[model samples]
Target chain A: MIDWSIIAEALPAFAEGLKTTMMLLAISCGAGLVLSVPLAVARVSPHRAVWGPVWLFTYVMRGTPLLVQLFMVYHGLAQFEAVRESFAWPALRSPWFCAWLVFTLNTTAYTTEIFAGALRATPSGELEAARSLGMSEATIYRRILLPSALRRALPQYGNEVVMMMHATAIASTVTLVEITRVARDVYYNHFAPLESFGVVAVIYFVLTFGMAGLFKLVERRALRHLRPTASGVA
Target chain B: MLHGYLPAILGGLQSTLAVAATSLAIACVFGILGAAAKLSASRAARTVAGVYTTIIRGVPDLVLMLLIFYGGQIAINRLADAAGWGYVDINPFIAGTATLGFIFGAFLTETFRGAILAIPRGQMEAGQAFGLSRGQVMRRITLPQMVRHAIPGFTNSWLVMLKASALVSIIGLDDMVHRASLASAATRQPFTFYAAVALIYLALTTISILGLRWVEARYSLGVRKVEFK
Candidate 1:
């Protein structure tokens, strides 16, 4: 039988780390949603200049690994004396903020694609009907387009969140004391790499597995109206 | 600093491309086999294929690469020792390629399986009616359609595998990312080097996307529906 006692004892520390993970996840997701919508919109904008920067941003972010991007933002760009003198330095200097920054941008690249695909999937019929009802272009988009695209985007956007959550483990490389860092410290102290990592792994597993379950529930809720037979049966 | 390191980074880029290309070829074999296995009626084969994909998908690629590069080599070396074998060594180059090929094959398996499923069932029946052998039916009827169906997913996976080829640098393969890291550290120009690295990756991906488009056009010519431009 396995030792339940160890896990019980480790619960508090694991919970603390879990909180940090959740906060970082939230920051990345929140920032990502705000950033990605504009990028997605710009990506499909008719104006060349509006979309040009968006294309370059998405291309660079998507092409490179997040580890390098994190290094670039936290270590590389910070190397400039001018940047250090800038007001943004304090925020950039903080490891948490920097990790969030890199993750936010990374998510922006992925979420831009997801949102663009979702926007493409939005029903044209609804848009035509809204236009015929004398809705202004901006109001039609505001009330009709945004809500519909958001609903379409949710499932894939959720996957982006999960990927970012997993990506957070690398933040420890830049000296952020997340779960991986804490586990490394414990491992060095105890000389039991497997045990320490195992403890931390359980926390990560619980987080990801729980998130998966919750997302499935949300997916079912989102799709319930689409399932005519199931809705009628229910 | 840039001039000094250009040759070294260029040398590393060759190895990165070599490993990715070789692994992708190896993965193609595993992908076909895995797709067939998953589609087989045998419960055991399907279950095995499912488990292989599940484990590969759940584990981080870096962690899997580390395990194979280190843990796999240790096991191989120990087996060699116990057998009193000599003059045989586990090469990281071979090991890294195999590990990446193994991981990416699981994804390709999924893609190929989906592609095979997407083929209309009647196509095979029609092939049979034309008196083609089973082999001919697969080769002439199914494989072409599967390739067409597989292109988009295959392109996405190829792009991902190209980026992931960087992780092998951790296991001591002198890939582009590894050389770039050394360059960044030595030059203290992390942003410039990283930005350059990003552009190189973009160039590779752009070239690959163009190649994929050519492949799709060639393969899809007979079946694609006409649309007004």
Candidate 2:
């Protein structure tokens, strides 16, 4: 039988670590969206010039491992004295910032594809209607295009968000002290794998479950018009 | 510098590939067994399969790698001392491979189980009616179909397994990442070493993605006829 005392002992530290994990998730996902929005639009550019580099950027980021990418920015960027002297040095100097930056770029690659796919899948009739109404490009994007594209992308985007939460566990590689890091510390201190990892496992499960539930809520809200009344009530 | 770079990275690549190959083979074998156990009627089998997947899946690869490698070392040293084996030292490479293989086996278990379930029940029934032995039926009909069904999920997991292989560096394995870390530390040209590592990983993944897609197409060859709708 597993001892409950170990869990009780680890709870406070785990909670603090959970806060940092959430911070990483929030910043990465937020920054990812900001970066992806332009990239998505650029990817669908009618001209090859805009689309080519955007696609390559997404591909390279998507193709590589997050840990390697984080290390590249964190340790790699410091190699260049020019980069060290550059205005961006201070931002890159911080491990936390580098972790977030790497994660942001990684998530951006995934989100750009998701959002771009959503944009392409937006109803042709709707686009035709928007143009027929003489709506400007900005107005069409703001008023009609993005909203429907977002609605279509909500479920996939939710899945991506949950995956990111799990991926952030790797942030500890850069010494972020997230939930996984705390678990490692506990394991080192007590030399008890089952007890330490068990606590961390529970925290991860709870977070994953909570994120899934939140995604469900967002999905329902996005598809409210499409859902049956009985479905909504339930 | 450029002359030495490719050769050193290539040596790391060979080692990384060797580890990945061994682990992937082990993972697939376990995947089959676990998937079969998951679909077994025995409650014990189901429980074991479920627990194996849940615990591994919930934990990240790096954490699992550390725990298993360190824990195994401690456990083995104790056993060796008690048995007078005279100070056995476990290799980091073996530990890293075992960790990746074990964790991925859990994932592949689910993929294989889901694939087996998706097979039409009537096909198995038809095999039984033809007076085929259970083994014969499984070999000819069930296993092949399951492989086809398992391909897509297997591909995704395989790609992921490659990336997860990077964690071996932390355990002091002289894979590409470890070599890069050392190279950067020795040269103080962190950008050059890590950028080289990242590019190598990207190259491997791009090639892997294409290869997996080809395998998927191969497995999916005869099964594309029927539409679900």
Candidate 2 docking category?
medium
Tens-digit per-residue lDDT, A155-198, candidate 2: 88987887788888788878889988898888788777666775
Model 1 clashing residue pairs (backbone): none
- Classify candidate 1 by CAPRI docking class: acceptable
Chain A vs native chain A, TM-score per candidate: 0.88, 0.93
* Runs with alpha carbons beyond 4 Å of true place in candidate 2: A1-12, A123-140, A224-234, B3-5, B75-88, B222-229
- Considering chain A alone, what is the TM-score of candidate 1? 0.88
Worst 10 residues of 1 chain B by lDDT: B58-67
lDDT of 1 by residue, A57-153 (tens): 8877887777767777877785588988999888878898889888988988899988877877777889899999999977976898777787777
> Which sections of candidate 1 miss by over 4 Å?
A1-19, A180-206, A230-234, B84-90, B129-131, B226-229
Point out the worst 10-residue segment of candidate 2 chain B by lDDT. Answer: B220-229
Q: Write down the TM-score for model 1.
A: 0.88
List the DockQ of the predictions in order. 0.36, 0.54
